[model samples]
Target: MADKRPQRGATLNRESNRFNLPERTADGDWLDDQAGIDGAPPRLRTSVTVERARTIISRNTSPDIGFDRSINPYRGCEHGCIYCFARPTHAFHDLSPGLDFESKLFAKPDAPALLRAELAKRGYSAQPIAFGTNTDPYQPIEAEWRITRGCIEVLSDTDHPLTITTKSDRVLHDIDLLAAMAAKGLAAVALSITSLDPRIAMTLEPRAPTPERRLAAVRKLVAAGIPTHVSIAPVIPAITDHEIEHLVERAAEAGARSVSFIPVRLPWEVAPLFRAWLDAHFPDRAGKVMAIIGAIRDGRDNDPGFFTRMRGSGPWADLLRTRFQIACRKHGLNRERIVLRSDLFRPPEGPQGELFG
Candidate 1:
């Protein structure tokens, strides 16, 4: 396998002031083919910064999502999934939503302490808190920062119910903490596997672990007595949609207890990013691929309506849903339906009110 690094205009350090395109432009300047730059490509370098977050509890009232509160210990994932919906968030920090979104990462070092403080609040109500809802907490940077692990330690200590959604297998590194939480029905994990094809997975989520490795992680988590689920997320039409059944079946075989899926979403800048990715990797089928996506998204590159956003509305959407349901039934996954119990929540001691009382 080729290194797959030095992708287009991406640079690993500060000295490389000039950017190079996958292919040169007509003007002799480096043109970033991925960003659709036909002229001179901008010279940019990836820089990582850390910010102290005031609060870790993110509240969500959307009827579409399963959990009410979530925590993102990091901002901007290093996994560099082109179709990530959270890419737009980088713009708020004066960063480009393109390469900068992935390379330029930010982590909240104080997340664990803040989480503990929040849980100890007088009015804190216990709901199954979610992790990796915005940016993956287990993204490559977590190894050194340990912020996500620390937050999990807090949850495990307090017996707070929690959920995790991540594409990285690094979650297995904290199995002891997760297993302890799971023993008390306080933890569940959802591994997001976009596709089983290595080639497609590489282009789709360039920095994420291999699909097989993630499945192995699922098996490991299950063997450790942790409840596991698989999310066949961002089901790109005309591309990986064909592997839906196979992927789900494999997940079930790996001991996944539940499964869920979401259609390809091109919210904000993700439309152009995904299109560029398709052109770079699958030039011949980019147009057809996007057409199917638009069909599911109601004739537009994206549909952002609250209810329709997660799962699009149309015949294509219905077909995907039907396929997922059939696969789930075939594998006997999601049949047990073990819902997290909120009644066992106990607020931490000190400034935070008692959660179990």
Candidate 2:
């Protein structure tokens, strides 16, 4: 029961990964044997590596997902959300999914050029491209890299349809571009707000924008004539589940045109990390929360199937669905899905520099 909470700027203790291909594990026992004391862990620092992506658009045909093409301007989000399913992706780089996933990040500096090139290809077809599917396109580093902004510029200029999802209010910084795209029926956005309680949000998503800030952003986007939605994502069973109705009501009042929720998913490395997070912050209800999640996930920490994974199975899942539906109905949210038009899409005129050449 000692204080397991991470230091001021850190979220995890940087544990070794169990899924690492080389199978590495840390042994503190050796240090104890030599110095009769445990060695202090290294201080975590955020590092950005530039990735020259050969292609910026990723295609997927998952039956559960709504989009076929998506773009992630960055990898390994710095938001440090304990329940982020994208955390496990760090394992592919031989890094710990715990602290390293957040501290070490990648940016696609050439995404805009690559995207333009791809769109200009012979058989390229217009479709709504999704952003922030794996990591927040507007994460903190975005302020310096501006990769997402560049991609947005290309999309807007070509009149290509695009959808964005993020928990950060930084999306508002692009209001001009987004508003223009929306006017052409080429843009929409969804903001994810998990809990209204700042204390819970601090512990769960240490670096993400506050829930209230996200709500305000929703209002701003809606007022600007952008089709905006609010996502009460990863509704923890015993913890944040109680706030579902209140969240929907507040979102509706804030001018969200639609609302949706997803049950907590603990896939791969996220399972252990989330369990540790629960023990640290919500020790009292951690067991109950995991039990309910197990019930929804069919006695497992995760369900990887196509359709069922998005919405878990079992009575708990059914109850969550019913509660969400009732709240949406009561608040008059989700009246219609925002559909962006792909017909307006036209390939960007070859590289901007070419005109001068």
Which number leads on lDDT?
A: 2
| C-alpha lDDT score of every prediction, in listed order | 0.81, 0.85
lDDT value, candidate 2, whole model = 0.85
Give the alpha carbon lDDT tens digit for every residue of 1-357 in model 2. 112334322335344456535432432322235455355443345789887789999999998899999999998988888899998888877776776677779899999989888988978899999998999999999999999999999999889999999999999999999999999999999999999999888877878899999999999999999999899998999899999999999999999999999999999878888887887788898899999999999999999988888899999999999999999999999889999999988776765746864
Segments in model 2 whose C-alpha atoms lie over 4 Å from true places? 1-43, 351-357
For candidate 2, the per-residue lDDT at 174 reads: 96
Model 1 TM: 0.86
Q: For residues 223-339, could you state the per-residue lDDT of candidate 1 as single tens digits?
A: 999999999998998899999999999999999999888999988767766776777678899999999989999999999898798889899999999998999999998888757
Output the worst ten-in-a-row residue range by lDDT, candidate 2. Answer: 1-10
